[model samples]
Target: MSAKPLTAREAYQVLRDIALGVRTMRRLGEKPLTGVYSGMMSV
Candidate 1:
């Protein structure tokens, strides 16, 4: 992967994909939990 930050449009697309994936997972009865962190992080 390139070590470049995503552009505004790219970031928006990523966020959309993430939201769609979460919705799909929920529909499939999958408990997808995302963990929020400041320094250390996880999903």
Candidate 2:
């Protein structure tokens, strides 16, 4: 069966939820964090 389409508001809310989850995960250090270095830096 085909799924029902979501309204614009619903779609926006879904995306917002995903962004919040990602931020939360970063805050919790559940994923490997990365940072950018300036100038010649050693790895």
**Would you list the clashing residue pairs of candidate 1?**
none
The collision pairs in model 2 are none
Off by over 4 Å in 2: 22-43
lDDT of 1 by residue, 1-43 (tens): 3357778997677668778884232222254435432232112
Cα lDDT, all candidates? 0.50, 0.51
TM-score of each: 0.46, 0.46
Per-residue lDDT, model 2, residue 24, is 30
Write candidate 2's Cα lDDT for 6-30 as tens digits: 8899767766876877423113334
TM-score of 1: 0.46
